[model samples]
Target: MDRFIECWNGLDDPRTGNAALHDFHEILAIAMCAVLCGGQGSVDMGLFAKSKEPFLRGFLRLENGVPSHDTFSRLFRMLDTEQFRAAFQRFMAGFSEQCEGVVAIDGKVLRRSFDSASGKSPLHMVAAWGCEQRLVLAQIATDAKSNEITAVPKLLEMLRLKGTIVTADALNCQRAIAQQIVDQGGDYALALKGNQGTLHDDVVLFLDDPASKAITAEPVVEADHGRIETRTATVATDIAWLNKDHHWPGLAAVGKVERLRETAGKTTSQTAYYLLSAPLTPERFNEVVRSHWGVENRLHWRLDVVMNEDQDRSRLGNGPHNLAVLRHMAINVMQKDGEKGSLRGKFKRASWDEAYLARLLSLF
Candidate 1:
């Protein structure tokens, strides 16, 4: 993978031959190392790369390559981040195809650069995640014209959704999207909200109408945080939505949800409505919903707080986007490299270990 990134990098012309940094391999490796070193900008990446040469040399054979901070910044500032992302996804094609469950469709704004006075080039990406495999399958940029709802179906077309359950928040609960997921041989578990005027009204009314009982199921889960004891649970799934055709092509079932929770000494909870393409009892629906939040806590929150992703503004052409992708790749590698330990600490270990870098590049 290191060689591949290096070779891919060399594909670009640096305009100047004798510059301190004209090679992509060295630049790419440095940028990647910077991410691994907790560096959040191109300058930081270049410094990190120089600071850890002995360790990097053990993995990347940069016989006589050293890119300056400006070189690193300029190269990334011009390189096609979207193209690089596509290439990386191609590299992980085999691993992505093995995904077995819900392929979540969502979008997140690179908040820090939303107002970069240089015109509206802020990147908005529609990402498809293999929820079951815990891997990001693919991502497409939503240009200045569209939103997640508009970008989803087009993105789904690029993926092979066979036997998968594509889940999303209320924003994606559209008729066309449901049809698209079913058409691709996949199921869906879209959240039901007020956006679907009639449908939402019906689900609410139906659940409230006393005669809505259809199935009975319950699940009890316990969790503790040293001093506090908490138990979370779900107690409802009975509804007619799960049995009706509802006009959804491959639709098998749909339902409502009731969540009960007791934390510390106080207990509070709310009911959330859901539409599922599978008759997975109430117990199962709750599991998927809870797991979905892991994306927020594990990936999003960690990136923002630990990796400091949301704060950086490396405002070059494709620089920011490319850097974001590199950071995610670094996260995945760090997670897979068991001995590296926590996300915050992985950069240190990655900077010191050569075999680890080789191992990361070799992984899917």
Candidate 2:
């Protein structure tokens, strides 16, 4: 736990005078442990601290005794989100090696974090998830979904993107975002859509042309959950003519993936286009594109379904965003755990077994 303390010790406490009874790092440490063991909000943190006071005191010095739920809530409300996020990044830097492979950037909403009386919308967060590492590299909270365009660049600035391929949905396929990715020594596979205006139109027109005859990969087929799916990836590297017209930054190739799925005898098909900074093989393109969904399937879904994130109603001040960071930290720790079981199982084990919880804390 010394490693964990070293990273978070840099955070400046917002509390002052009599309000600063508990040590900032100790409260943060307790909160981290609570979330890792299935604690949801301030109440859970307080209960967990009280119940596990002995286990907590092994590493933390609770000179002021356990803090109340109100203390946990107030600290998060007043905490500077930017500093907490930076501390989270610092902690992850020490916890893992250099980030590599597909780093998927996406946004998720804290659906219930809005305050009806205060007229606030749900908190929207843009997160960069390292697919190979299965950890959140960095995140930024935006006021709305449309702000993701602005929020994404800020999120990118916090990451070490060298030698990584960043992927994002059509909403984030802006020219500046693409340029930023290339300028940072990273490649991009941004989805193409109508939002790109003429660029999207030209790519679709060219790829759809019969004479284009793009190189196609052997169709991949999979069957599961009472459904059969087939995906075929096609790539066209002869984009010099297109580049001459658009001059997109680092433009090397364009790609198309056609997916056909039959579920309950109902057939559905989707065709997605991409702007690539490098010419990737159809197979490699398939891998990169498929890995992008890991941010949703592995991170977003788990947060909402497994961790009950959306149901959390912490709608005061910085509470929502700060708690979101804690959730990400908990996930990173648990994902790094080598124990053999599902995440849900790990939470149960951690909650019931203090030894196992200590083992997880030691990962940092």
**Top lDDT hit:** 2
User: In model 1, which runs have C-alpha deviations exceeding 4 angstroms?
Assistant: 1-3, 6-21, 58-65, 143-146, 224-246, 264-267, 338-340
Off by over 4 Å in 2: none
What is the C-alpha lDDT profile of model 1 across 96-134, one tens digit per residue? 546576677777667665555766566676677666666
Q: What would the per-residue lDDT of candidate 2 be over residues 104-184, giving only the tens digit for each residue?
A: 999999999999998999999999999999999999999899999999999999887899999999999988999999999
Clashes per candidate (backbone, < 3 Å) = 1, 0
TM-scores for the candidates: 0.84, 0.97
Compute the lDDT of residue 138 as modeled in candidate 2: 91
Model 1 earns a TM-score of 0.84
Provide the lDDT at 74 for model 2. Answer: 97
**Superposed Cα deviation of residue 255, candidate 1 (Å):** 1.8
- Give lDDT: candidate 1, residue 279: 70
